[model samples]
Target: MLRKKTLEILTLREGSWAIESAADDLEIAQKAALQFLGKPGVMGVRVLKESVGDIGNPAPGDILFEKLRSTGGADRIAVGEPSSLAPVCEDIEDLFHGGGRTTVNRLFRAYLDKNTVTATEVMHNAREMKRIMDFESMLPSAISKVAQMQSRSEDSPTMGERQNTLFGFADRLNKRAKQAESLDLPSLANVEINEAIHQINKKSNGEAPGYLFRVAASRELINVRNWWGKFAMSVDWAGACKSDPALANLDWFISDALSNASVLQDLLGDQDSLADALISLIEIADGVRSIDTEKAQDATSTEATAAKINGLFKASKLPESKLAVMERVCRQLQGSGALTKDGAEEPKVFREMLLRLIPGTELTGGPEMAEAITHRQSHIINKGGEGGLKAATASVLPALRDPGRKAGYLLSLIESDLGKDLLKDEIEQHLNGLFMTPESVHQIVRTGAPNKKMEKITSIFYRIQKSNLPDSRKAQLTQHLDELLASYVVDGKILDRLDDPNKPLHIRAFMLVSMCQPEMLPDGKASKLAREIIVKHLRRPNFETELVAQVPDEAKKEKILRDFHVQLHRSGFFN
Candidate 1:
């Protein structure tokens, strides 16, 4: 392993140092050097006093780049062969490890980008490596931590205890309903109805009795028992005796399903069974919604208008379509580092099932998710403590197609993992970490629903930009940059500046660096633009800065690597 070297990393305009000549590898070095130095305001190490081309040596511009062998002082470094920049994430991780502040985190990211490297194989491998490390190392720990905190906080609340009681009450209500006449066995009808009346008597509310009465008047059982006039108009039963088709209308199948729904739901319990049974019972409720459910397919202006669009989904009845929709959504979730194939464990099974069932759920993860996730840390207030995020996620299940709503589930998981001990700062910190993924970028932009943390960060950015961004409203610079860097527009230009060369070097550099973030450059254009920037502008001494004490030793050849970055910045390659 190479010793980690402290490098005085140079920018386009920084000081120079010593470097070993490496003309023997000049051909490869030149192209790599050219590529690295093409971008303006290039960030790299300055390892040499003179460039290879300057000394008139064979392959004059190239120099050998390595960590100093015999304690070569900083001055001993000189220009050298072009070098491969470190992987973007690993580099940023290193920067963080080195105690770089968030500002530097932003700056280095905006400038020296891993996207500058062109090899797809290399980038893919690096990204995959990073992804694996993040998932394997970070996810479980994050989840457990959140769960623990939530559990602890849950204990603090009288509300959670109450909610639990509500849950039990809800369960008991269902059990009581099952004992009612509608769902109970016919032989038990007399006994159950009596019991139901007893329970009804206990209800001080006249509403409960009325609801029970409607269920008690089951026409089907009444006809079999010939018990007319007791709970219905005796004439209606007599009308059926004349064999009138209208009188015998068994459409009560629908109404009966609906009227008995509450009791049935209680019998089934909550969760999936209850959800499914309730959905079925909605048909009866639909009848109730209509003035005449028998004429359900009858057209009014509204139904007539809706008919055209209603031809989708339910009409298609294509299970494959459902699966495809689920697949698309799951892929997006997977890409965002949210879910994926697990060798030893399944992805959150409920979410997986929801994706499979709703198919359209993937689409729901936009604004709805954003709103849900951003509902505040207090939303995940525990089962009954308050409005907690988890409760919010459950409540908004029907809105799963809204990214904002989908965001709730994601946020809850994160909240659950991080737990309540994580103050606002901790939540924001984790979110900052989470937002680095390509998936998160897409969710943020498409959904227009920003997470709590992103909202804060975005507010801060616009605030600073308003005050400090140059007053040059010169011909819409960023729009122009987007055009030139379209190839580099990963998921669309996140911060596409660089319109005028006359702009401040740091500003230009900032835009250049933004194009390099993985979230900002998923489209693979970051490297293309970076190459152009490096080829033109990376040799000057005033366009950039040199961070000598920071670039650690493990870099294969420190001087060569640093010089490579500097030249790239000088060449206007980034612009």
Candidate 2:
């Protein structure tokens, strides 16, 4: 049987080699590598061929063909130990801790990406440290770049001072590198990380769990090239990480990677439509893992993914993952362009998508999702030019026939930037027409049952309170509503129920007391009238005796009287 073969193109930058591309054919891989070798800043290129044993149970195969080439010039620098002012790193842990690891990541991102290596890989591997130290221009380039950036700030150190600080950092790294070489420290490849950590702890006073974790994680990432691969590798380690307090850094690393924009984009993949992208993003934000299917690996079925996302949202343990996912979704939601695949703002489609996003926004506690939706609305309105505002306002006019729907539509418009800027007066006029009109007040107070009337009154008051309407407008509307309620109470003879001879004295008192509650009567003329009526009854001769007369037990009668007095006091009826 013919051996299954694969070929890869590798590029050299400074002293490091990174895999650039891969192909199934040797000629295609070699041509691609040769073409890349001639590009500016590319020091060299190598094409290596490998044999695969089987489809299901593949084994590592020998290199069947290999070729290497380098551009002739100053680019071909001999691998020599470069000198710089040492940094403050005292050991392997110091090199990978704090800002040191960030610096390494920034300096060697390309190499890390190409090799599927992490900063953790370099920190524990002596050979990797040596490889970095051999890059003669790496430290100087990093120093110069940092100095340039820092020099832009008014409070920044002088270039020389900044250079000295960076050089000191470099010197520290060099010192640690030399120590690792002298000690013949084993690479992550030579020994398992847990064993390495155990061995190191025996020799040293301090334990290095965080350091060892990164080393093992890096090994797991070996030959994995894409962002999805990194994300998956990080996720696989998450369960193991939860048991060890020292693996907090590993958890943070995973979170940080998941939170990255590029990583999220890759996770969503190239969906056929924006709607597909949106559903996939929601799934990720909701902490739904991709399902592996027989037809395709790591395939995300939209319906299945959304269902899973909705189910897992409340139960998800990974809140950071959800946050990261929502942030990306928010960005897409607010981004410029039509939301639909056909490049048109279809209202029905937009509404459906927004409906889907609302639950996600609540699930993730992201106000940005709401804000983004408003921004998108503004964009759609602005795209229509001057007629946009007029058209939107006209669209709202149809809903005026239905007060509840009108209120909903108006509130949505008022929350948007364009609506705030251009339609403030219009929105305020509409709100006043809706709530402050004499007909509107009469319609609410006169039509419903006592409870239904109270519900309608309270609903209007609540809408006013929750709106972004000005304080003065809110106060005016509330005062008007209160006045109308007070008039209705008087005109409808609602207080006359308290003096009715047919009802029991306690029943009349109970009804009056219920009206005095904040829920039933807000702080206004209506509430004041209810309180005064209750106080009048409370001050009447033999009122307590009549109030509790039906109670058979002397103790119960006394308790009822005392509780009534307390309730009256709490309701602001001092008398």
Candidate 3:
């Protein structure tokens, strides 16, 4: 390499040096004589004195020059070329030969300190050095040292001192990591991050590592906005589902997995995929709902409604819908920095499920909606711990108020034993607050009852009968039922042949008694009117035949008869 030199021209005046010209070179020094004299275009400008030396690498005397040379000073330095890689290689080798953590630490610092050296260049050099020194096998241990140093630093007496050292190491390593992000660096970064997370989980027993997630997110090791996008783009979801039912969880972690708070935030923010998964589960549950509703619609007596719920989870894809996978997603989200104490925006899919399941606002994230209604109901009824009817009813209220799915959802809620009793006093209070209109009620009924051709019809009779609504609302409900039943009762006579069978007659009668409160008549006029209708029906010779035909089980028949006798006695009919 050639070095640029400068010359200093001076005149000896009264034994003091007087500068004439300080030029870039010896030739320029000669031309600069006249210029320095303030007579560049004038004649008779005489040269005073001249001498030259290296500008930045000046040697004062022979002894100084010898000392500088001995130390391999500027004389040995290369110009317009980067420093040799030999030193970096030597330092790496020294570290491999037990130079300790500092050696590796210094290597990273030196690699990043060069203005000319980028992460790509350092990556190339590191690979070459590894190959030349046969240091591939030692890489794992060196990487392990980085993590070990960090872990040890945590135990140091003074936090500042340990933090300084750790930060110093991290500062350089991260700079290199940013440049060599695509370099495939012996899995050092991966090992370190995994170690940190593993240690945190072990210590905290699976608590999320908020700080670590933030750090990883800031580094872009994971794509926050589209964490799952990359993985989703890589694999065929259908194929994975077929191969393993638990693949959703695997795909979540394996796909451009979380590396930072931003990515985690993005993951939590994105709910479409999670919603789709939940919707899939709901569709399956709705399938079972359809079966139960069909059986209820076809049955002649309530005893048939007691048949066990079965074939709900019969789909082969059922295993893929594990709650653990959803829980894993929640775990990833829970660790996000976005979920600060001030209550940040929640993850989308989980929030959607909550809105559909819980009673509060759109942001509700409680686990009240975690399980399917049947599973939750079964859990509440069969197991004795923690669950109460009040809670179950509160959960169902959101469904009841939903105009789109209220009917089917409400039916599903009442289909189970726990669900049937969910309509308690407090829940009815919530229902009243909903201000459910006749139209919404019509939609619910339509959705609940499917016709012979499987076409859905609006039928609020079941909900009206089952709900524990207050008298005022019940009276309003009766008006709606009267309007509905008017089509069946014209000129004060039953017009539908279907009512003559007495099976549906019981269902209609139950709905009427639930609405009218027959025992509350002041003058006994209402009671007499009710009894007259009942007697007219009972006097029909085929009443016994129709009753037996509807309830073939003799014990169930006895129970029905016994209940009617008690109802009649209470209504002042027997007296």
Better of 2 and 3 by TM-score: 2
Better of 1 and 3 by lDDT: 3
**Models, CA RMSD each:** 36.6, 17.0, 27.0
lDDT of 3 by residue, 1-575 (tens): 97655446543333334454555654455434322222211211223223354323334441111101112354322112111111222222132211222233233332222222212122223342333122211222233333334344345334334333433343344443344434222221344444433443344324234322322322332322342342222122222232242232222232212222232333233334434534433433322323345544554422122121113123323232222223333333323223222232223333355444433221111121322442333222333233544554455444344432343344333333344354434434543443244333243343433121011112333444444445676566545544433332342343233245455655544433322233222222223444456667678888655544566688977876677656656655566
- Can you tell me which runs of candidate 3 are displaced by over 4 Å? 1-272, 280-312, 315-404, 407-488, 491-575
TM, every model: 0.19, 0.42, 0.22
Which candidate number maximizes TM-score?
2
List candidate 1 segments past 4 Å from native: 1-309, 312-349, 353-426, 436-575
Residue-level lDDT for 55 in candidate 2: 23
Greater-lDDT candidate between 1 and 2: 2
Best by lDDT: 2
User: What are the per-residue Cα lDDT tens digits for candidate 2 across 1-575?
Assistant: 99666676676777676778888887567545544543446665666654234222223343433334433366443222211112333344554544444445555565555444566555555566556544434444455555555555588677656665655655555554445444433443355544544554454434244544454455545446665556655554443333443345554455445544566665566777666687677766655646544423233433333333334444554554465466567768777656676756445565666555642102122334544555566565564544555555655344233354445456555655555666667777777776677643456444657755764675566666776667897899888888877887888788886558688777778778878776677778987887787778878998888898777899887887787777777666774
lDDT of 3 at 211: 24
